[model samples]
Target: MKIHNFSSGPSILPKEVLQKASEAVVNFNNSGLSLIEISHRDPAFVEVLNAARSLTLELLDLKDKGYSVLFLQGGASMEFVRIATNLLNKKAGYINTGNWANNAQMEASFIGEVQEIASSKDRNYSYIPKSIHIPQDLDYVHITSNNTIYGTQYSEFPTVDVPLVCDMSSDLFSRVLDFSKFDLIYACAQKNAGTSGVNLVVIKNDILGKIEREIPNIMNYSKHIEKESMYNTPAVFSVYVSYLTLNWIKDKGGIAAMERRNRAKAHLMYSEIDRNSLFYGTAQQQDRSIMNAVFYLNEPRLTTLFDDWCIKNSIYGIKGHRTVGGYRASMYNALPIESVQHLVGVMQHFEESI
Candidate 1:
């Protein structure tokens, strides 16, 4: 039996997607070669790359004007630095919602001036900060669409006159979004998209020509955009896997369908959390994440006992981050409704056992 993996990253992918990926690993497109061994420059891999890029745009409903998608290596972490180096000239505004958002601010500070417009640090990142005051003169405003660690998400993004850059590492393609609002969006293809190794970047074409700073060709978005994401050898296997995942998304009725399923899963778990006497939902109710539902027990000892119970039941990766000792169930796109139901059963059983 396959274990229900709730890991935040390298997270669960659809079983069909995994099976298809396994076949490709042995004989990609019946090319008589493993996808891992194939040349990135080969026509077969080139088709994979183009399809991946095209499907990403199609799924996001992005048009040609001002937006270009690039499949690059070096996860979203690298883009934290690259975005600052390429875009931040005088000043940039950052919203510190969680660890990843703070990391982006720290990286931007290394390159240039980065102002923290708003932060939820005081609340232990349990809720998204509202009333962010972006500086009028800042070059760009950066926001993390979802806080993976804290289980808080922005239901609606703030309005900014300047260019908007978003680190959508956790929630990319999880729902229908206004891609045109963002001047640049970057995501590590591990959570909802695909496995690790490849980073998907979507940037506005017009914003490419505005960078006056002298940076390496690799750091420049324009370079990758111009070369069709082939400025250098890409993460071919990850890209191909991502393409398969995108196809899976399309087959399952795209983002709208996934959004409905995600909401249903979130409701099942969160409703249990609210109703249970032993457990308490961690994140604010209004800003709770559909991807990661975090909660804690009233009795600290119950936390350990509950974790052990989950493990014995073959439900894994529900332990919360060390920074915040609790439980987090990462219900990514591929986590089945059955798994969420199983978890809810565990929660109910634990209450009865106590």
Candidate 2:
């Protein structure tokens, strides 16, 4: 049986991406070299890097729009520090939506003064707080576009006068959005892009080198740009797979098509959650994430029965995050609607059994 994958982050990837990447692991580009063994400076690997960066810009419609795309090694976790180190001089503002957003603010504090403009933690991050007042004096404002752990998403991004930076790790390329609204957009390539160990960082070309403090060569944005994202050896496999997956996305009608499909999948699962007697959704109606649908069982006694059923039915990684108890079905850009339907069938069947 083909197992359905539902883990959040380092989650599902396109079937074609996985298969092509597997072949390249042994022989990349038929050049008698494994992708892992290839040098970053090699012509073949350079082609992959260029393709990944160019495709990202093309997909986001950021080409020649004062933006530079870089495929960096560290995941989104390290970007919390890199962002602050490069941008934070006097202070910055953050909108805390979940654990990752809060962690980003904490990391920024270690670099410079940071303020929480708004937070939804009091409500257990069930909803996105609208109408946040961004301080005029801050260097930049950071927001996690989607909260993966709590299943809350900003249906509409906050408008601010300052530079709007977003961590789009969980929802990048899963839908269509106004990409130009952000001065800096960073995403770890685990969710909707590629596997882990690579991050896609896009910066508005003019957002660098205003700070008075010294920035290390490695952490500085200008240096990376100058080196063309080749400051050092890169993650060859991750970038190659990311390039292949991006091609897959392009072939599937790009972000517009993904947006429609994602909305349909989310609606299907959330409708089941609302109608079924066994489960209740944790997120607010308007703030539910299209990528992650999180809900919990109303009757706790049926947990084991449902779990056993899931295991027997080839459902994998539907368990919720430990910080928040429940189930999270991460329907990324690559997850077909059939998988969501299969999960809904399981939900309905388990409810009937109960």
Candidate 3:
């Protein structure tokens, strides 16, 4: 039986992507060298890097838009520090929606004055704070597009006067949006892009060189731009696999297609949760994530039975984040509608048994 992967981050990837990545491992481009063995500065590897950068820009409709795309080491976790180190001048504004948002804000506070313009933390991050106030006093406004832990997402982004930055780790390329709205956007490749080695950063060229802080060579966005994301040895296998994943995403008709399919998948699963007697959604209906659909089992006593059922049915990665324990069905770009339907079937069957 095939497993329906619902793992969030370092999560599911397309079968075709997996197959191609596997082939490259043994013999990269028929060069008799594994992708892991190839040097980052190798001309062939350079093409791969360039292609990945170009495709990222193309998918986001950001090509030639003066934005520099960089696939850097360190996950988005590392970016929490890098963002402030590079962009924060006097102050920056952060919206505390969930764990990652708080993490970004905490990291930024270490460098400069960071303000929480709004937050859903008071309610355990079950809902998005709809009433937002953007202060013109800040240098830039930071937002997390989706909360992987609590399952809340911004269906519509705020149009702020300050430069808009987003940590879109979980939901990047999972749907359609106006990419031009953001001055900076960063995401870990583990979720929708590829395995968990490289983090993608897209920053407007004009935003750099404005900060007063002397950024270290490694943390400077402008320096990374100058080096073309090869300041040091890059994550060769992760970047190559990400390149293949991006190719698959483009072949699937870009972000527009992903939006349609992801919407359908989320709707199917959420509808079951709402209708089922055994479960209910943890996040508000309006703010439910199209990528990570989180819910709760009504009766905690049956949790073991349900877990056994899911395992018996070849379901994987449906367990919720340790921060908020229940269930999370992460429907990233690669997750098929059938897998979601299968999970829904499991939910219904369990409900019937209950």
lDDT of 3 at 114: 98
RMSD of every candidate to native, in Å, equals 1.0, 0.8, 0.8
Model 3 ranges off by over 4 Å: none
Which is better, 1 or 2, measured by TM-score? 2
lDDT of each: 0.90, 0.91, 0.92
Point out the higher-scoring one by lDDT: 2 or 3: 3
lDDT of 3 by residue, 152-252 (tens): 99998888988899999999999888899999999999999889999999999998898888888999989999999998889999999889999999999
Best by lDDT: 3
Model 2 over residues 39-152: C-alpha lDDT tens digits?
Answer: 789888898898899999999999999999998977887889999998998889999999999999998888999999999989999999998887899899999989988898
Q: Write the per-residue lDDT of candidate 1 for residues 1-354, one digit (tens) a residue.
A: 658788989899998989989999899889899988988889988988998888888888885655789998888889999999989999999999999999999988999999999999998898998877777999999999999899999998999999999999999988888878888999999998999999999988877667678989898888898899999999877998899999999999999899999999999989999998999987999999999998889999776788788888889888888888788999999999999999899889989999
Instruction: Indicate whether candidate 1 or candidate 2 has the larger lDDT.
Output: 2
The regions of model 2 sitting more than 4 angstroms off are: none
- Pairs clashing in candidate 1? 66-204, 66-205
Clashes of each: 2, 0, 0
